[model samples]
Target chain A: MKALVWHGKEDIRCDTVTDPEIQDPRDAIIKVTSCAICGSDLHLFHNFIPGMLPGDIMGHETMGEVVEVGSGVNGKLKKGDRVVVPFTIICGECEQCKRGNFSVCETTNRKRHLADKVFGHTTAGLFGYTHLTGGYPGGQAEYLRVPFADATHIKVPAGIPDEQLLFLSDIFPTGWQAAAQCDIEPTDTVAIWGCGPVGQMAIRSAILLGANRVIAIDCLPERLSMAEAGGATTINFETESVVERLQELTDGRGPEKCIDCVGMEAHVMPSLPDTLLDRAKQMVMAESDRPHVLREMIYVCRPGGIISVPGVYSGLSDMLPMGAFMNKGLTMRTGQTHVNRWTDDLLRRIEEGEIDPSFVITHTVPLAQGPEMYQVFRDKRESCVKVVLKP
Target chain B: MFHFSNIVRTKGDPEIVKGGPSLKQPADQLARALGWFSIGLGVVELFAPRRVTETLGMEGRETMVRAFGVREIMSGIMSLSVDKNAGLWTRVGGDGLDAAALLSGLTSDNPKKGNIALALLMVGGIAVLDYRAAQDTKPRRPPRDARRKLYPNRSGFPKGIESVRTAARQIAAHAKTHLKTHAETNEVKQGDERRVP
Candidate 1:
């Protein structure tokens, strides 16, 4: 089998690798039919991620057909069932799972995914990226060994397009989580920072959840326009102060909920070197330069509002105002999205035509072109909201 | 609720009108035991404050501190358990630790032991009150919310003690996570028992 390998900083290549097998009874080996690069994958491409090393598998978002299941595997899922595997590998019955925090499951990716030669250190568990999460191999390859399959893999309901369902692996549910964190009250207004695929979905979710108004912020005309089409009031942060526009729109109360879809790679003027993580995050979302938008998210939200941050923050960075957050009584919720929680609902919405998230998927590349497509993504030339790689 | 007066206050004169034994003896014992506990805690904190802080996360600090504050109040009640002549009173005061100080301490380059030592000192302050309360007669039980505060309160300390008990169980559960991090590393060799496989 072959996988898209992350060789080093800004370095990724398609390489031949060992075929995956069922290493555990609860495991299932799947033949990946499609996969997409996640924003966090770009975090791996840049040096912001600590544990990932050269030649580690690249993509986390996947849709595939199960070819084998381990001996003790239950749930009655068969070998030929088409499924969407969630990005986070989780054991269904762990203490974390019991608390509904499935992303940080106790029995998820226990095996080191990245090859030993990549990094000198081992990590807790995560698919394909590296340690920091257990380094289990990822799905950007011909075959993917999925541990805790019953807990992490969701069957694609019949009638859904493979392209539309691919996102169920990450963005669809992540976008839903960002929206869910708003804890929307029917009359509330929401401001979403960034208008990439996830941000677009968040706007859709906010509307679906009955928000009175939705505001989308970003610099790109294409994404901003998409947001407008989706019924969101668009704000080009490059042209106007996001906080000002939001206050003016909300009659000085600010939006009830604010979300940071742009993570560390936020766009800001006179950028700092340390904020490269912010920039890298932007590039993953297919943006080039931006200051950290999380700060703006804080400045623009109402005093007693919620800030839902689903953007990936690897390790820790500086510059959040804890005192202000405390003084304002703002409730901020974050961490990796527990996609399993929202996958079923999101898929149903997609099926019902209540949403057409597939519009955000602007590029489709063959598996072999994964490397070149990444460059197109890096250059921000295609206005790519998402790039699906067909295997 | 039992009536509180200057007699239970333990004012300027160490030797008041009359009681079984002085508050000094148990106060001193608790102080000594606290010193030992402080050293052990300091060792843990000194070596791994980041581990503790990370597990505490953003909202956890306030919750943990409130819990510890309640535990301290309980310790004050437990102190009444020690000295019959001693009295129990809950001290409810101002905002405890500033966020800047909390962040600074959390991300500090200070020796782990020193951080633990400081935490122990805070822990000791409450332990002393607990020890003293143990020695006193069955004092009035305070309400849950009132007793755990470090400052003054209208409702007595018994309820505060129960709050501490609940908070302690929560804190203990959180504390076990830190221990598990180490325990997992040590057990990695023989254990293929990892839930994910």
Candidate 2:
């Protein structure tokens, strides 16, 4: 099998690798039809996120037909079942899973001790994320071995194209959760920072969920344009003031709900001194994340409003304005998306012709070109927004 | 290294059979090598400044050497990071400073003029490499103001945004009606209880 393997920082290679085998009874092997390069994968590509080994396969957004199923899968999954494997591996029997907190399912992280040391608890194992989350070989190849496959997959209908259903594995649900956690109201204004893929999805999601207004912010013109197409009033943070524009749009009350989609690596610019400082600290290993968007969100959100974060922050962040957060009586909600919790409804929405995630995919190529696509995606070249790899 | 990584794998994880072309370009690899070289040179200049000054016959300039070392180390760190282009450019600037300093020591009074010339030649060579790496590793992203292919039609909505919003509004209206009815029923139940009492 050929897979995109992480060699080092800024180094991905399409390497021939041994095919995955079913090590556990609940495991199932799938012939991956499509996978994607996610924004979070850039964290790994930059070698910012720790725990990736030299030979680890690099991807998470994947969907395919089941080629083999272990006995423990029972009647839940069988050969020929087309399913989108959610990034988070969950054992459905766990207490967290029972509560629909699938991202923190208690049974999946094979390296729970590492996660316990770092996060104070184990998160659900994620494919190709890191050793702290299970160190599972991801689905960026011809085949993938899905652990807890019976419970960790979203079955999509056969008629839909892979591009339409691929994002159910991660970003679509991630953006959905980001918007959903805000609990958007009809009169509320939702301001989203970072118009990346997740941000783009969040824009459409806020609109669909009945927010009175959705404002998308980014430095990239193309991304801002996409957000505009998604019914969001776009703000180019490079050219204008996000805080000022958002306030202007909201009649000076500040947006009622704020979403931070730019996580660890906020764009470093001279205009944003905090971002520069965060980048400096990050380079020195003093901080694990750049919380510029977090700071901005807290400072600009309406008093008594909600702050929803679906961004991937690895570890510690510095200089957060807890004073503003506390004084404003804000409620902050954040987590990895329990993808399975929302996929069924989202799938129904997709089937019912409400939304099509494929709109975000601006690039599609063979799996062999996955390495170069990582560079293109990271650099945002060719106006690249989303990349899907066909295996 | 792949074999070493394999040691950490559990029973059924895939192992690398044969590696293929890497995403890292030649210039990127060159930048990496230069970064390590910068760090190594910086470490020496910082810790053994006296030795460097003695070799170049520029004694009593240890402080200046140490400052250069710090600059080199910072550049090296940046070069080794995702911002390697910046690091390489900094190295190029540092190379100019290095050449000027060495030229200052090229007078007849200096006993180690030969050593200074050799050092100058090395700096000149490294400068070229740094310049090349800096140019090659520059981000391929278009300029912020560059005209781009805009996506004004990709609403992600199959049914248009208006329809989705209208449907959501209807749902909200229904929910409001249901809540109003429930509240009215509660008020009536309270009234009945008070009358009975």
Candidate 3:
């Protein structure tokens, strides 16, 4: 089947990869209907996440119909049921899973059983990524294998559009997790450190959770404006020192809660420049772009406030002031969203018309135009919010 | 004065009195009280820790820890902080009086300097516990997998076969139910809340 393959640095092309078949009883073969280009996808183009081999099919955020189910598959899901598959493949019943922590399932990457022992103490298998996550193929193809189908895929309610349910794969739950992690109290002031799609989603979620005021910080005019439209006060870090402005607004205490929507690839100075050229190339053009926004998040947060970082960060992080964090009594939380935990509620909310997370999508291109959309998105065009690739 | 001998007989040993309440429990209570006191000071410090420290005229971190530690210990040892009338520990006169003066002395000292010391002391214990947890040597936990046991154990399927079989059975049941409902044309259809394709 044809899949968008990540060959090498800055190289992604629609190519014919092997069709996915159900190899395990708990597995299901899904025919892709919708997939998206996440900011993290640009990482492959930029070579941020290493071990990128030729013939790797990219794109994790996807929703599709079950074409076939393994003999042992359950949950009453059947062939043709539309479902949203989580980016992280998990086996739902390991020590971490029995405790409701499915992200780090022990048997995640195995074809039939858990790995011989385990991978590096913690193992959560993910799609289309290399050996670090057991290298299960992703869903940017005509058909893809879904492991632990009962645990990973949630059938979408009928009334919800495919575009809306597609984000349930990663971005929606991630943004919700970011806001929930902040633990913002009612009427509390919040400053999200990025205004990307995830950041904007968090902004809306912050309001949903009753944060009376939200100040969004980003260098992009488009993202900042989007934040404003989503009911958040905007801050352009490029034009002003974020900490100083936030302090001025908060009577010198800073925002009571801060969520870092920008992860490792944040548009900071020197090594991580937010220059127009870089933003155009990385955020707009690349398929896997994750820029760290941690420095800004810590700067504008109030003492004793919560800091939630849901942006994808691999291996290591830098430019952090542990002393300041410890001294100020800030509570820090960083991790991948447990998407399955939020899918039911998010789906219900969507069905009820309570939230239209699809507002972030400003562009929808045919699946074949993925290569072009990648460039348009990477260019940081003024009009871009999110790109939905319809298959 | 309520003497130790008047209320109850000492049982553990002559020197180590068992009948009279020793300072340990009282000290623990005082330590807890001090925790709340420091938090109140912090609330004020949030507005102005420096002001509180200056008004109290206390030393910095070191002095605050010793002073707060000594205060809690003295409160526990004497039971004087809890009740002023019970001053048996103060029978030592001048030394006891000097120790008893500390809590009262807080208001007289520069609030800025006093809070600087007290906050340091108050936060120290929690810091140590956190630091120890960080330094633990346990292996980083391995990730978990959930597919191994997808079925209820009561079902007569083998452990390995249970999950897939149970899932298949459930899927078959759903299909059967849907077919039955559709075939029975006379049956009324309540809107299925969980609509699936």
Instruction: Look at candidate 3 and tell me the lDDT of residue B12.
Output: 16
Indicate which candidate wins on TM-score. 2
CAPRI verdict (incorrect, acceptable, medium, high) for model 3: incorrect
The worst-scoring run of ten residues by lDDT in candidate 2 chain B lies at B1-10
Better candidate by DockQ, 1 or 2: 2
Compute each candidate's TM-score over C-alphas: 0.62, 0.97, 0.62
True-vs-predicted CA distance for residue A238, candidate 3, Å: 1.8
Interface RMSD (Å), every candidate: 34.6, 1.0, 32.1
TM-score of chain B of each: 0.24, 0.88, 0.23
Q: List where candidate 3 sits over 4 angstroms from the true fold.
A: A111-120, A268-292, B1-197
Off by over 4 Å in 1: A111-124, A271-291, B1-197
Q: Compose the digit string of candidate 2's lDDT tens values, residues A1-391.
A: 9999998888889999999988889999999999999999999999999998888998999999999999999889989999999999999999999999999999999999999999999999999998999898988999999999989999989899999999999999999999999988899999999999999999988998999999999988789899999999988887899889988998899999999998989999998899988987888789999999999999999999999999999999999999999999999999999999999999999998899999999999999999999988898899999999998
| TM-score ranking, high to low | 2, 1, 3
Error of 2 at A127 (Å): 0.7
Tens-digit lDDT track for model 2 on B13-76?
8988898987767998899999999999999999999999999999999999999999999899
Between candidates 2 and 3, name the one with more favorable lDDT.
2
For residues B119-197, could you state the per-residue lDDT of candidate 1 as single tens digits?
A: 5466456545544534443333332233221101211112332343344345456767888998988788557566456
Q: What TM-score results for chain B when candidate 2 is compared with the true chain B?
A: 0.88
